[model samples]
Target chain A: MSSPAEYAPTARTVPTRSRERAAYDAETVHAILDDGYLCHLGFVADGLPVVLPTLYARVGGTLYLHGSTGSRPLRTASDGGLPVCVTATRVDGLVLARSGMHHSINYRSVVAHGTAHRVHDPEERRLALDALVDAVVPGRSADCRPADAKESAQTAVLRLDLAEVSAKVRTGGVNDEPEDADLPHWAGVVPVTTSVGEPVPDPGLAPGTPLPDYLRRFVGA
Target chain B: MSSPAEYAPTARTVPTRSRERAAYDAETVHAILDDGYLCHLGFVADGLPVVLPTLYARVGGTLYLHGSTGSRPLRTASDGGLPVCVTATRVDGLVLARSGMHHSINYRSVVAHGTAHRVHDPEERRLALDALVDAVVPGRSADCRPADAKESAQTAVLRLDLAEVSAKVRTGGVNDEPEDADLPHWAGVVPVTTSVGEPVPDPGLAPGTPLPDYLRRFVGA
Candidate 1:
């Protein structure tokens, strides 16, 4: 029996190495997934694997991927569902250790294994498009012009359920072996975070329009 | 005959959508790959695609990936070269437009399609290991204790040639339609950059040891 709050471990979700770092709890998975807008979507093409970086949004138990109608993965998915793996990582710090072999990265990542299906239903596609816009900026979907029928037809929205998901997170400072602790090396962690710079307005933006409130809020966050 | 300065694009290297964003020049690909230490490596496993985020280093035309001997990818490569895809992306900014469908991320990404092979030569393996350490912090390889024989044997180094590679980059501001320019929504770009926090020294550092000069240089970079 599996608990509602935690994803049940399957053969694919379990890590063969670093077993301690894998987290199947919903909190960890959702937190890692929501932190980034970019994901590397992987799928097999002609018996060879291909990975492409693209934008994605997560709503409830589903992950929505944004891509073009002509994209190979999207076209394959539209015909029927295609097996896909989505991975997103948030690098928190660089952990410098006393030995080159011990150096590691402090990061939180989510890897989802499932089949990706194109969202054909009109209402779900509409909502998924909005979610993709908001994924980049909070409340951004409402501020933008809605897609017309022609525009909607050109875009492809892929949906993958978040059932087989796992997150692996590494934190804290260097983990030098006891014997190597006194080495001359300067060992520690350099924390990393995403910093937003001053927003650059479009050259033809309306003359007096102010920066949106949500953007300011995003900057503050 | 192909130019020496640029990689010749194959059928898979070309983009089906937004063809203008693709570049096959060596300069563009190297710049994007050097800016980040993490990469998503994709390979087919059990006839399904698997994408795992891992640390990588580039040396000339070869990219080195570090992993444990027990790792599936490394094990498979050790037996015989396996088809693989490696992708690294650097998010430059968020491009907000007047329409939801037009919003796009300002990013530079390199997607390489190739096969991965395990490093068996001792001298090459040693050099690749040093490159991997320096990839995280420049000049870091010399600062740390060198890996001993046992440690070296336990670590697996996978090499992938950067031949079939393409870099896609999007920069500058939003591309809102001329007709939608007057929409009240604010359209602009929020520049994104990696910010490094103060270095946190390890709890077990020697009493009089000072922070290394290389780490300071990394912070400035």
Candidate 2:
């Protein structure tokens, strides 16, 4: 995984702080993206920076994001390739250091800089839509009906190439000063985990409709 | 809570899609922000939009984000007021609809557009840093040693007013079409939750060092 051929971080994706935590490997970047269900999408709207939370899925070296046709960001990108920044983060633990200034989070995050273009091809859009659904719960697309023509026409999918991507990860315990370490303060890491609770069946679910096997073992990132 | 004095969403902060989910009350906005300890901060650098995940705490009508003094985004803001967008999202559940196009996540998110400026006042910085630590685990700051002069000097705290903030929330079960409801596909909501596991003590902890009471009751968003 340390092979240099995996990923090449551009200047934009490189971290200006804690460079030791920055990773430029495809494996690391993909793992971080795959582990998370949501991403903060940043784009310039009317020359003002706008960040929106959206669902995303990573398929190989490309990331797919879906929204309604009326979504401002999607509509803006549909006109042409819109320069966008997408970031996915998974907080693994809360680092409680001996000092307030030293408090931090143990997290794995990936920042991607790319141009997002709306997927116009019907076949590709369908595949992207499926990927998005399956990204939430593995094998979910298989258990559900695919979008019909009218539903497909109303949705907008955007694709971003994973060209400029880097993952920054912080792990391990708190880093307290040597002097502060002897203080009576309690310092350690509180592990944070995102997990799926019991599935709530729809009120209108048909009798004897069983919960899908994929959902029973579903674990969020 | 619906009073007009609470929040006034501008054209930029208004939702262009799913307008029903958009919320313009201060209580809603603050609640969403308070529940999450992390936020995706968006700012433009050299004409390119950048989004980074960082720890944040909401104090009154202002949100404080702290980072290394050497961080690019913080340095960029310290020069002058930098237009920034901060977004926090919590995925409550995965809404699996009968059709792929209707798939969505039940989430609560707040998108705030404001200008962030570095906090230079020492007293304010201390208060903000304390709020940040306590934000992760309630009453954590009291149990931890305060930041020393040198540590505070090296850190950069940016304050963004929560004036132009709005929360968008999506809840409830799958909204499948009546026609597709009869499809054999299974549809429901898988609840997602972020929880705190048992605290991991530091390897170098001194003998008789007890786990703090705050961590025992810690509950993540």
Using TM-score as the measure, the top candidate is: 1
Docking quality category of candidate 2 according to DockQ thresholds: high
Give one digit per residue, the lDDT tens place, for model 1 in B14-58.
999789999999899988999988999999998999999989999
Worst 10 residues of 1 chain A by lDDT: A1-10
Top model by DockQ, which number? 1
Model 2's i-RMS, to one decimal, reads 1.1
The residue-by-residue lDDT of candidate 2 on B99-212, one tens digit each, is 887888999999989899999999999999888887888899898878788988898899998778899999999898888878887788888888888788777788667677
Query: What is the model-wide C-alpha lDDT for candidate 2?
Result: 0.85
Q: Per-residue error at A176 for model 2, in Å? A: 1.7
